[model samples]
Target: MKMDLGDQGLAGNAAAGGRPLAIEARGLIKRFDHFTAVDGVDLAVPEGAIYGILGPNGAGKTTTLRMLLGIIDPDAGLRRILGAERPHDVAHAIGYLPEERGLYPAMKAYEAIAFVGALRGLPLAEGRKRGKALLEEHGLGYAIDRQIRQLSKGMAQQVQILGTLVHEPRLVIFDEPFSGLDALNQGKLEKMIRGLAEKGTTVIFSTHVIAHAERLCDEVAIIAGGRVPFAGPVDLARDRIRPQVRLETRAEDGAWRTALPADARREGRFWNFTLPESGIEPLLRALIEGEAGILSLSIERAGLHDAFVAIAGEAAARALEEGETEERA
Candidate 1:
């Protein structure tokens, strides 16, 4: 649980780190009167990266996005959007999908998109054509002329997504973009999000849910109670995660106990190990080449779930200790 502040560059260090950041926030702090919503958070999203922010509800993900969009000013921090200092200056270049979705129920799908496009200064005629084209491309062409309220939940969500992209922004910020869709719709949306990234749009989004982020993001930063617990590439996070391996041997033998790694345990006939750095490979070779007939060996990499568990567990421990200190004082 020890924090490793490695040599990875911060989000806003443009002078030294010349790699253009798709999105950057440094020392971001948000306070509503006396209650701090977002603490000092440092987040860096690389260009064309589907960066994920994960935490439970009320974890300040929405608040942080609000600050970044200039909906709410941070108590203090630095933020840049596609290299601009102010959100309004680059607002047209940023497509936002807020966690709480709102669209005009009375407006037709194409009408809504055209309205948004016009607001961003795109021509009404072009917006109309592209909006209808987007509908057709996403298989929502049938609903293009229908009022928003006439469409199902999934259909409405698709319209919102289409509208967000109508301006062809450089960056797309989607807060819980997968929240309300069915499995099929979710798959479609996932493909759409990845497609946007493939087309070179930078995406940074927050989710209480982990699986979508795991499937979509190249890198992730986990925040809890408004502070980051871990931030790095997915592999790096996996490495930092508590290393646990699942191995099943043939003939259902419990002989694994004799040659097992130090921290290994037995469940039925399977041997599980929480590997330390030194003894993984040698231990695996010993298990495999020796009399322990290996049947099915599956090494379970610590996923975002494990990462979040590790993160939240540490945060709880820290909060407990700090509360105890206050009580003692």
Candidate 2:
């Protein structure tokens, strides 16, 4: 039976871009004995978007995902998946790839994909057919008949990813999806995610790697210390701080230096600072009149890494760095 989720107004009716949400959670809490693994976490994943859950290891990302998938019920709060209050009721429309990946080592690649599809109610024959086609499209056709144990580590991961899609789920959730893949395979996975969103599939993946989220996600939730410090469009997060300015000049000291912001620092012959609130035009005029030989001037917006530090604090950011170091190891 579907439990009443009450009013959904808290998470809002739609995403900042006006797209309908595929997943909505409000004040979600989970506990393990006396340990509170997740504390009042909330998420709003827009439909047909590439959403990212970003954090360090053990920041409750996995626990929150489990709750969203209905693998475990939250101790408090509520969620809706694909318009259903009960996530399992719409299980047919969801695909999940957990952080702990496993497959029958003895099973053939194609058969493994088909088996996964069968678990989601797809007919075996059709699943096999689709699985073979998917492998071919992904350049794994030669491995279709190869046993899972016979394939390289990267190939095995590719097969598992294909299995997740063989059932053609409307919403796909991945927990630390890039955990074990090398750079090449990671790039391949990023491309695959973009393809899914192009086909109107909603894809949510959790990762500690900020670059992947920075490149691929439409919106993201930054989870740290078991709570979300930031959520919504990726640009909005970066926009919390001003764009950085880099000015290269032939003049080392001139009247133009006075026009530079108070925070401006001299780095050899260059001036680096945050763009001032009054904007750059006045600064440009000052530079020209003062004969400060401008070699080059550029403005760069803050990237997600910088935004994450600014929003989630240095401690959480350090945890993120340590998690990344461990992943690299």
Candidate 3:
């Protein structure tokens, strides 16, 4: 019988409930020779959440993930995956896509996918059956029998991802999954990640790109300089920074100038400034009382990038921006 790769039933049957924490780590520390890579990190990933570990390159994201998967031992700290203190025993229940991509050039796409499932103790026949269905579902049905070397980069990546999901692991971890894809492929990946979460799978991904986390994560951890400076709901991170206000006025008299705070900067007819703690009401009242005819006013909520700069400092933020710029170019 052909399996339904689009079946949401996988989540219904395997979804974790009541157990609030799917992954937990306390005071995790890792060092390589003399260099301390991960220092005193704590993480609490809620069950079934789309969690993100966000940071620039060399931020210890890979190290932390390696520790969590038991691929490497932490110098200090404790971690639990799926309620098991030791990840090795329950390793089969987890699916991981590493930062590095590797596939045998001569291997057929379907066989390569099935091979990954076999590593997780799945029957080869069953793995191949599901692999074909998953490929078809992800718009790669024609590539099922194609050699890995013969496929395009995006098609190869899609096959690899299908391999990661063929076994239907409860927890899926992706490290820089969007690194090489174009905008359209990135959008497709984002949709796929959301679909996994809707089916009750706990998805955790690490990326330097803030936009992906902003659009997809329920909670995120901001790692900088080998330490996690911030971790919580996405809203809480944004809440730490004040909203920006942009106001354009028809009147540019002294009264209009006086109404704005000292920090306000005028560019053309628009006054751009950060909202003060006293809030927008006071500013609006002052502007109206001074007869500054407000042509337009807009309040822009702080986004993940703003929050990152506020919390992780400008250097880290700059790295992220530069990385994005390079990708675009």
Candidate 4:
């Protein structure tokens, strides 16, 4: 069956520059009894961009996503999806993959994929056709007729992802999409996300893994303890932390020692410290003039991990590190 194309107007509006924001939430708050889960979070996702919501476990990322999807209403906030104040009418234009995975064990892979598409306003026959094409394109052609229980965990995930995109939604939302996949599968998913953006689909996903956000997101919001401390381009977040300089020299006792920044720490013949606002040229000149034999010197630029540690605090950074360690184990 042919799918209704009513929601195509939303995508056209974006192409025509009617509204640049595909998703927006302002002052969103959620409370469970006396305890608040989400606190005054604001978000803006540009059309055709891959946006990431990054936070440690229990940082209210899922709650914020649910509210934005209209699966649950926020106690205080305004949210718009595809320019609609309420998402109900535009629900069919969006595709979502929840953190939790579910499927009938006995269902065939194709049927499962098609069923999800049907729910997204795709007709069963059309869903099946598209599902088959997606599976084959993703290298799962042999598994189409196989039962869900017969497939491996990674294969099952690909089927689910195909289901999410079968209806060709304009905006795709994935909550913790890479939680359980192995490294290879995770890499594949990353490529798939980029491909979606290339095709003009707005993508938003929540993750605790900073590496994914660092590699995939055009912009990210960092949330911790139910509040967002930073949100914007990845480069802006990295700017929150200072760059470090590492130096090793044969001559230790000289004007170079005095020229070192107050925060500098010496470890044997090496010195590690952040660059001063005055810059490194003066320090380099002092080292040379002081007869300090500079064996090697290198500057280390700040990364997303460093930015997270600075903006979210040591406690939240520690939590994220612990989570990654657990995932690896």
Best-fitting candidate, scored by TM-score: 2
lDDT per residue for candidate 2 within 82-162, as digits (tens), equals 988788998888998988888899999999999998888899899999999999998889998999999988788889988
At residue 319, give the lDDT of candidate 4: 91
Number of the candidate with higher TM-score, 1 or 3: 3
Q: Could you give the candidate ranking by TM-score, starting with the highest?
A: 2, 3, 4, 1
Which residue ranges in model 1 land beyond 4 Å of their true spot?
A: 1-19, 248-258, 284-290, 314-329
Q: By lDDT, highest first, what's the ranking? A: 2, 4, 3, 1
Give the Cα error of residue 15 in candidate 4, in Å: 16
On residues 1-329, what C-alpha lDDT tens digit does candidate 1 reach at each position? 12223443243434224656777777788888789999988877888888998776677889988988888888777777777767888888888888888888999999888877777677989999999999998888888899999988878887888888898988988887877777788899889889989999888888766777789888888877888877767777777676777777775555545667677787887778776567467766776766677777666678866666666676644553453344335
Worst 10 residues of 2 by lDDT: 1-10
* TM-score, one value per model: 0.85, 0.94, 0.89, 0.88
Look at candidate 4 and tell me the lDDT of residue 250. 89
2-105 per-residue lDDT for model 4 (tens digits): 21224332232232235488987777888999999999887878899899999888899999999998898888777778988788889899999998888788
Model 3: runs farther than 4 Å from truth?
1-19, 254-257, 325-329
- Go through the candidates in order and give the C-alpha RMSD of each one to the true structure: 7.3, 2.1, 7.9, 6.1
Model 3 poorest ten-residue lDDT run: 1-10
Candidate 3 C-alpha lDDT tens digits along 34-107: 99999988888888899999998888999999999999988877777887878988888899998898888898
The per-candidate count of clashes, in order, stands at: 0, 0, 0, 0
Output the TM-score of candidate 3.
0.89
